[model samples]
Target: MQILIAGASGFLGRRLVSHLRDAGHDVTPLVRRPPRPGEVRWDPTSGVLDATVVAAADAVINLAGAGVADKRWTSQYKQVLLDSRVDTTRTIARAIAAAPDKPRVLLNSSAVGYYGDTGDHAVDETAPAGEGFLADVCKVWEAATGPAEDAGTRVVLLRTGFPLDKDGGLLKPLYLQFRLFAGGPMGSGRQYLPWISLPDWLDAVGFLLERDVSGPVNLTGPEPVTNAEFSAALGRVLHRPSLLPVPGFALRAAVGEFGGEALASQRVLPGVLVREGFTFAHQTVEEALQQAVSSITQ
Candidate 1:
């Protein structure tokens, strides 16, 4: 299969590209820069994508978006978050719609934050969306793919959870603090972290690429751990004691509304993926942490 991936240089995108290539699929990276040895340039920002580039793809995975937790959610940053997602998705959808031979699948990205603070309730793909900034962003983010879906493309919205990669993402900040022996649970430590190992995340994408699955699929580990549990698990894996607990006020002062969302309870599960026969490489938090830490150290 010929696969075209947008944002191919990003954290998940890079992994997805490697996964697709390793699986014997011809992978093409769509970027803003000129086409390199194996990459194809497509400016989603200015809506200047070459139709022939995407029209030739058997599948197109859209992962182009600004990081939600990259910056504090000021009004300016909020707009960045919204536009980066909605606009890029819109651009891709339009390109796919205009393509002569549309891709069979369009796996667009979303987040488990779609369920907003679900407390202890385990949310599946069928769960109704919750309220707040991240949720609102995800709602529009998923909706922006309608053009391609309407054009007969099988659009799948991957409502991703926290991807547990030791080299990057959420682990970066924690790893530093843990190495300094100042890492522990954030806020009340009760907020559930619905996280996925990078391997399982890539595997889930491959599974969807090969299957007829569409709509929202939660790309999360089967086991959802609390912030406290996550802290302790990482600490255990790193052979360190997680003792420094961050207070809610301090987090709010640092990250504002987004910080509150992070600290809020969200016990999301990968119900749909499991029920659909998708097996996980790391089912337990400890196992996932071990793999992530091993990758980081080695």
Candidate 2:
């Protein structure tokens, strides 16, 4: 199968590309700069994508978006977040719609933030949209796939949680801190932090790519843990002591509204994946951390 991916240079996209190639799929990266071998350049910001580019893909995966945690969320950066996701998605959706031979699947990215603070409740894909900055962004971000869906494309929204990659995702900094014996819970330590091991996430994506699945799929682990639980698990994996906790006020002051994301509770579950018979290799936080540690060591 031919897979066209936007944001292929990003953390998750980079790994997905390698995994897809290993699985014998032809992976074509859509970039903004000069095209590399087997690559095509498209400018989402300028809204300049060739129709031929979109028509060639058996599947289209749009992972292009501003990093939610890249910088402090100022009023301007908030708009940047919205445009980066909604605009990029719109660009690809339009291409898929206009293409003569439309792709069979359009897997657009979203986040568990769509459910906002779910407290202790484990909300599934059927739950209603939540509130706040990240939630609002997710609402618009997922909605941008309307064009492709209307054009008879099978659109799948990947409402992902925190991806646990040793090199990049959420584990890198935490790994460093654990080595220094400074690892600790943030805010109240009661908030849920939905997470998935990178390898497991990659496998899940592969399972969905070929299967007849559509609509929103929560790309998270089967088991959700609290911030305190996550901190303790990482510490145990690294043989460190998680004795400190960052206050909610301090966090809010440091990163603005983005801090609210860390402090807010969201115990999300992969309801769709389980019902579809998707198998997960890393089912718990401890198992996921073990693989992450091995990845770092090697």
Candidate 3:
């Protein structure tokens, strides 16, 4: 299988590329800068991608987008978040549609944020979308992949959860606080955090690529932990005591509207993937935290 991956330099993207390559798949990364050894340059912002790159690929996994939680959600940054996802997806969809030999599968990236604050509700692919800025962005983002689907390609939208890795994503900030012995629960500490370990996330992506699955599939761990449980698990794995608690008001004041989403409850499960017999490499929060923290320290 020849796979072309956008955002191949990002945290998850880098890992995904390596995983695909290790599986004996011919991997070509779509980078923004000059072509590195195995990378191919394609500027999604300007909609300038190499035709040769898209034409020769069996699948195109679109992960190109600005970081949603990278900055404080100022009004401008909010627009940047929405436009980055929608525009990049649209660009890739158009390019895929125009390609002579279109890729068989279009694995577009999405988030669990599409379900918004589902308090204790088990959301499957059949669940209707929730409402919010991120939800709206995801709705449009997924819809943007229509071009590829219309072009007779199977489109798989991965509604990813909080990918657990010590070096990046949500874990980085938590690790800093934990190193200082100040890491604890956030807000009420009751919000259900649907999370996935990096290895499991990569495996899920590979499973989707190899299978005949399409539409929105929740790429998350089967065991959903609350914010407090997650913090305690991380603290236990690091052999550190979690003492500090971040108040809801502080987060709200610091991040504005976006903070609410972070604090809200969402107990999501990967029903579709599990039903389809996808086995998780790391099933529990404790096992995931141990591996993630150990990897960083080593």
Q: Identify the leading candidate in terms of lDDT.
A: 2
The candidates, ranked best first by lDDT, are: 2, 1, 3
- Over the stretch 86-145, how does candidate 3's per-residue lDDT look in tens digits? 888888888888899899999999999899889877777788889888888899999999
TM-score of each: 0.97, 0.98, 0.96
Top-scoring candidate (TM-score) = 2
The reply for model 2, stretches above 4 Å from the true place, is none
Clashing pairs in 3: none
For model 1, where is the 10-residue window of minimal lDDT?
Answer: 42-51
By summed lDDT, the worst window of 10 consecutive residues in model 2 runs over 289-298
lDDT per residue, candidate 1, 27-68, as tens digits?
988878667898888777788777788899999998988987
Q: Which ten residues in a row have the lowest lDDT in candidate 3?
A: 44-53
- Candidate 1 structure lDDT: 0.89
Residue 95 in model 2: shift from native, Å? 0.6
